[model samples]
Target: MLELILALRNALVQQGLELRAQEASDWQGEIPLPADIARFYRDIGPDNCNLATAGNSFFIPALARLWRMQAGYRWHGISGERLTDWHDDWLAVADQGGDPFIFETSSGKVLHDRHGGGSWQPAPLFDSLEQMIACLATFDAVWNSAGEDIFLDDYSVNPRHRERLIDALIPLLNSRSAAQSLADELGW
Candidate 1:
């Protein structure tokens, strides 16, 4: 089993790919999270195509960033966004029980827990598609279009950080017991 893991890892790396693990806080719970929910969390990242959970370990691609790490997450890529206000607004919306469509952060305040932490604001009065389109069109014409340069500039400073990012590769690949256990549990 371990040999198979090693072989799989080697095959992947030979193809210029890496098997990186993106940690999830949900997997830290005593009971395993629902597979559907876990997969949803894993999909928060652009590159995370598969999600598997064994015991407390949830395996996912390491390239996931804060934006793609959680469900219904949003961010504003403005250059001078501040954290204090962001948190305040998030809490405000959360207090209102509204789910916000977009999350915005600027240069001054770095969003903490980009993967899946910090506070959230619930979006009010825009839950419906019509409301969402209306809200977005307004925002697009007012804020997004005018501030496009600042947003682009922020990403340009560190473009890699904005996209799926994997900093390192696992030096040792495959855990045979783990593979066997997974197969056994799945009846594979």
Candidate 2:
């Protein structure tokens, strides 16, 4: 997991994005973060790197900001009513636009939920945090290297680049189906 996190940091650096290390004390939440997740925040914390594709904006907040974000997702803004489906063990580690990528403390699996779905039900996205970081690193690589011909005027990925992305993701994800699912989720 540390290797994957470093690789992701290196990949982002190659793209000229800067990331700063976070202190362990930064994570003062009542619910303890999984070790790997905590390591990620400590090694490659938040940044405004614009990890945006035509499909989604991948944003991972700093630990300090996580609670507010989680609270909003867990409770209705207007009514301040708690969402029955939102679980205490599910911590939102990242987000695709408004949709959250949740870390399940009990299962050690990463799940994704579509925003405005009106429920907290999330689908399995990755077997572990390591896999999720690997996918992100692969996506960063492919997205940066995609030629102009691989993108339409609207910046959506062309089919060629989409195939390239899936190919790149396969080995990192260790499953063709998982790679394909990630591409589909990215709308590639």
Task: Give lDDT tens digits, candidate 1, residues 1-188.
Answer: 44543554444344333334344663533333444323323432213322211112112223333333332333334543344434422211110112233322211111112223456432233222222222222222222223334234434312222111111111121344433332333212
State the lDDT at 41 in candidate 1.
Answer: 37
Model 2 error, position 63 (Å): 1.8
| Residue lDDT tens for model 2, 11-128 | 7677665467776677756666567667766777654434645466677677776666676577776787878788888888878778888888889899998888767789899887
Give, for candidate 2, the lowest lDDT window spanning 10 residues: 45-54
The estimated TM-scores of all candidates read: 0.20, 0.83
Over 4 Å off in model 2, which ranges? 1-5, 28-30, 153-156
Which 10-residue window in model 1 sums to the lowest lDDT? 164-173
Give the clashing pairs for model 2.
none
In order, what lDDT does every prediction score?
Answer: 0.28, 0.74
List the candidate 1 regions with Cα displacement exceeding 4 Å. Answer: 20-60, 63-188
